[model samples]
Target: MRPIVVTTMLSLDGVMDSPGGGEHPRAGWTFKEVPFEEAAYEIKGREQEEAGSMLLGRVSHDEFAPVWPTMPEFEQYNAMPKYVVSSTLEGSEWNNTHVLRSLDDVAALKDSDEPGSIIVHGSATLAQGLATAGLVDRYHLLVFPLLLGTGKRLFSTDTPTGGITGLSVLESETYANGVQKLVLDVVR
Candidate 1:
């Protein structure tokens, strides 16, 4: 089966929202609150290089579609196939984008003979669903030192793990700028 990886940036308190600017009051906290270190963002380049396709939820798709395509740095991702999991979103104007109606579609996509991993960018709701349904194979997390104390978290009390899910750390590093990179595999 194709691997599904949830990749995200989080704060010390586990807040994962508005790392790169969103509707949150503390949007853009990643750059504003934390120091920018080139080494800290190396994971992004590696993820972009390794990911075959991208998967996003309606919110992230709406947030990224308008800006990512215009940015030259996102050229590689802009060319790859993108799947947006949204029941309400009817269509997409983004390049090579496809709309998936449900998590079942995500499961089918994962079951397909697709090459490389499906990298999920900024989709907390979808990530929670995937994790609860036991679909996420790996996680690429970059945790910053600052804590906003009031944003959407990566893991919450309501997140129901189907069973005892263990995460084995595959790789880890603490960047000079205090960002921690953690690559964890979900042990089934």
Candidate 2:
């Protein structure tokens, strides 16, 4: 089975929303000021290429579809197959994108002829659902500097992560600006 990775930009306080720009409360900790000199963009791009498809939440898809389609540099991403997990969204305006209602869509992806790793980006809600269904294979966390004491967090609640264990740190790179790129795998 292809690897499933969760790629998210997290603040020091583990908050993942509005770090750079979003409608959510940014708490004056927007990430544009934090220079990511660690080749973060390059790394993410490489990973995206290897991804068989991208899984996203409705909110993220709504926010991303408009801007990502216009950026020529992100053409590859725009062309890639995308799976948007949403119960409300009926159709997608973007290319090579599909709207999924249940976890069965993701299950189909795992059994289909699709190749390469499947990366889930900026979908905390979908991530939670995938986590519950045991869909995620690994987590690629990019921990940035600066913390938002009170904001939208990835792991907002104090719930057990399905007894996650056998955590072996894979790769770590500290940026010149103090951000840390960490790759972790689940040994199962």
**TM-score for each prediction?**
0.96, 0.89
Go through the candidates in order and give each one's C-alpha lDDT: 0.89, 0.77
Please estimate how well model 1 matches the true structure, expressed as its whole-model Cα lDDT.
0.89
Off by over 4 Å in 2: 27-30
Predicted candidate 2 versus true structure: per-residue lDDT over 120-161, tens digit per residue: 888777777777676777888878887667656666375545
Error of 1 at 77 (Å): 0.9
Candidate 1 residue lDDT tens string, 1-188? 88999999999998899987877889998899888989878888898888889999999999999999999988989999999999999999999999999888999999998778999989888888888888899999999998788978877678786452699999999988899999999988
